[model samples]
Target: MTEPRTETVTLNGRPFFLRHWGNERLPKLLLLHGFPEFGGAWADLAPLLAHRFHCIAPDQRGYGQSWAPEAVSDYATPKLVSDMAALIGDAPFAVLGHDWGAAVAYGLAISRPDLVSRLIIMNGVHPVPFQRALAAGGAQAEASQYIHYLRAEGSEQKLARDGFAKLLAMFSANMDTGWLSGATRDAYVAAWSGPGRLRGMVNWYRASPLVVPKAGGSIKMPDLPLEKLQVRCPHLLIWGADDRALLPEATAGLEEFAADLTRVEIPGTDHWLHHQKPQEVARAILDWFPDR
Candidate 1:
């Protein structure tokens, strides 16, 4: 298939870089990428679903050529949600997010259910269960240790050193590096190498309030009503069971928050399942979407 078109549209007074596929007249699917990644993260998976859905993946707020606000507070949840809301406007579309993007997707569903028709998350977490697991602190707490490091000052420079060696290593967990061929690696380098982009991306971790407990400490769970956080839309989860970062416990009890939830697990795949098994990810997502 030919490469998707690229464009930048102003949203919330910021230029948002978007890579789009298929006919613009088709139904829309907003694909959100996580930290250390840009819109092109979906390069492999988006094409598989392009025929049925208009795949529109953005560089998000702090990645790639998109606007990079230096302040960590600027990347707060409310601001992130508003950026997406502005993008959707009155249009009805399904939302798909991976990693940090998944957080924003959940935030959108919770804050403005009317703006989202369906929610699809890959290796993403919900507030309640994730908080519970992080608070409980054991295996997951250990796996999430990197979160604290990323949140530290000057961490972005560490990730950017040696051509983003540490940042790229994040994706190498539990998956072959073959997916990140020379071309793919160069694209990511360019995205992360953007001035102020690394700071903006890392600010996501800094801006988040999720308390991942230290090795042995436990955090009390916050009281939040399901009514306020419920994902009323049909939601589908495509998980890579081998994910080392966000453990299975993170998504456990997710059903309580989503009214209609479909869980699909692909064994032998990790956090980069979309990259390792793009075809399978596409098939599962297409099957879950309305009208197939």
Candidate 2:
């Protein structure tokens, strides 16, 4: 396997970091990381896919060596989309996103379908289903209690001290010893420890651009309706059946959006499918790529 090469690129006029694996002759795969993480989230999976495709993972703004701005709006959807568009340029590549990156991927496919020929979302739901689930006010609320903690002041500092380690420990408790390696843990800590990283990450929850209704109000989807938007390209959704955060119900009606959707469920896996089942995840994506 070839070692991934890191490169510096400018997105939305701010410096960002990207790591690429495999030869330029292969199909391009753009990987997007989730909250509390950088592009390195795909480190374990990239090498596995490199044999067949060129994979590039970017450290989203405010996450690793990427530019960190003080204002919350800097993390807004428009700016984030613009940054992704700039990075995508003329390359019509496939995208895979997890968590916040998944949300961004959804927006990107909807806003600039020209750039994304395919999409793969792991452990993320459309904002519409998420909001409706939140309003349902029973199990959804219980599952989402962590969001409140994230939005609380001083949460970042607290996480920096204890929560960070706690999250890392959970991976060990839930997965095989071979799954959670020292290098992976170190990379996660390094990215999470970056200056203002946690704050910028939590800003997604605090400064939600989506119109969140009152407690009992009806839930409306985001600007793009997952149902109406015909994903005119190939789409794959890999979901962990045992995900504690986002329930299986969120994907209940996903077929409405995907004209050509292939769904795969890992019976025993959790939300961190890449970390828990790296090889499996990587292999699945490689098989899904066009002409792979």
Candidate 3:
């Protein structure tokens, strides 16, 4: 098994920490992690794919040792996408993202199609369909209600109280978390314990423009320009069928945006499917791009 090599690279005058697996000479694959988790979140999956590609996982803006700005506006989609664009320089690479990281990955693919050769999303949603699902006040909206709580004032304190009991509960809610124990659990806690890291992580929810309506109460859907949001690259979506937070509705009509989209659902797994079944996820990815 290949261990990750850690380093810091400056993007837009800000330090973004990165973890590298496999040889630098290999084909590049950028890995983006979601909220409350750092680049290390890819530890299990990256090594498996490292033999074929150079796996690069970044802490992103608001997590781990990356440059986490204080303002909510700093975490906006454009900035997040720009951070990634800067990191990759001029090379076109494969991009894989999970959860909030998927949002950034989609943004990158949409905004800079030339830079992304392939796109992969693990249990994540695109903004247009996700927003529609959120506004419909259905299962997805109800499941996403936690977004409001995380966006609320002093949410960081609430999540941090009692040694992050609330945060841990939220992470393990309706999902198998047997993998998140001992040293793995300690690593996550230590990352969250970083100064302003909790607030930074929560700020992703606060900064997002997607609106989640109350259950059984519908809201007007915002205008999303489909032409502008289309993903031109070959896209693959790996779903954990049991994900409660992001229901099937969240990914509805995703094919309209991704001209070439492939979806594979791994059974008996939930939102943290990557953590729970890295081998299966890696196999799915490897099978999808056998020539890579």
Candidate 4:
């Protein structure tokens, strides 16, 4: 098999970086990376699925070498969804996301179901269940306190004051071996400290106006209907049973959106399930693509 190649393309007029592996003629799978990371997060798993599919992992805006827009609204859900759609063009693809990427993928699936054929979320809650937990208070609020810190002013200064040591620490503390190497970690740190990236990354939390209120209430789109919002194409939920930020309660009602959902729980793994268990994550994705 050939080594994966890194490439760049413009999405909605913004330059984005991506890495692709596997056969061009095969079906395409788009991997969305989480906070403070890059397209390299899927480096290890992409090749495993390469023989049968074209795996494309992108460094969502604000991280890696991708374009990081200064405006907070640029990181909004609608814009992020547009960016993904623009990146993939008219191609039909399956969407796989982890952490923050999972949130973006959910919005993408909701706003433009036509672009995404299937959805796979790891270590994140479904929007409906997430909304429910937030209304219930306590755990949801506690789990989300970090957002306050992120959105607060002087965040950039604070992050920079420590010379981004905390950011680097979080990356190393959270992810597992396959997700990043020492060299990759250095690259991530550099990107975060780069000209406009840190501000762009935190702006995602700042611009997510739907989050706080939505967490405080249930899904508001009665027209679409949560139950009927199911992705008929197919869906998979791979979770790290030991996830810290998202607990089982948040996943309590995922069945509502996944008509044919396949739930796989990775024992002893944390919120960064993709990194903690890349082989298993890859296997779950492979199992979902029609034939084993």
Decoy 1 TM-score against native: 0.97
User: Candidate 4's residue-wise lDDT over 1-292, tens digit each?
Assistant: 2467888898888899888988778888889888766787776678788887888888899887888888887887778878898977786788888878888787777777888888888876667777666556666656665667778876866776666866655554543535455776666667677678888888877987534432443334322357544566577888887665677788787777767788888776787666667688788777777774
- Looking at candidate 3, the ten consecutive residues that score lowest on lDDT are 209-218
Q: Runs in model 2 with CA error above 4 Å? A: 166-178, 210-230
| lDDT-better candidate, 1 vs 4 | 1
Summarize candidate 1's per-residue lDDT along 1-292 as a digit string, tens digits: 4598999999988999999988988899999998768999999999998899899998899999999999999999999989989999997689999999999999998998889999999998988889888888888888887888899899999988887888888767655667787888889888988889999999999999888887767778766676788999999999999888989999879888986999999777888888989999999998887684
Candidate 3, after superposition: displacement of residue 51 in Å?
0.5
Cand. 2 Cα-lDDT: 0.76
lDDT of 3: 0.91
- 76-176 in candidate 2: lDDT tens per residue? 87677778888889978888889889888877887789999899999887666676666656565566666767667876777777648654553344334
Q: Using lDDT as the measure, which candidate wins?
A: 3
> Cα lDDT for residue 84, model 4?
91
Q: Write the per-residue lDDT of candidate 3 for residues 151-234, one digit (tens) a residue.
A: 999999999999999999999889888999988899899989888889889888888888878766779999888889999999
Deviating ranges (above 4 Å) for candidate 4:
1-3, 169-181, 210-229
Q: Rank the candidates by lDDT, best first.
A: 3, 1, 2, 4
Residue 274 accuracy (lDDT) in model 4: 66
Model 2 quality (TM-score): 0.88
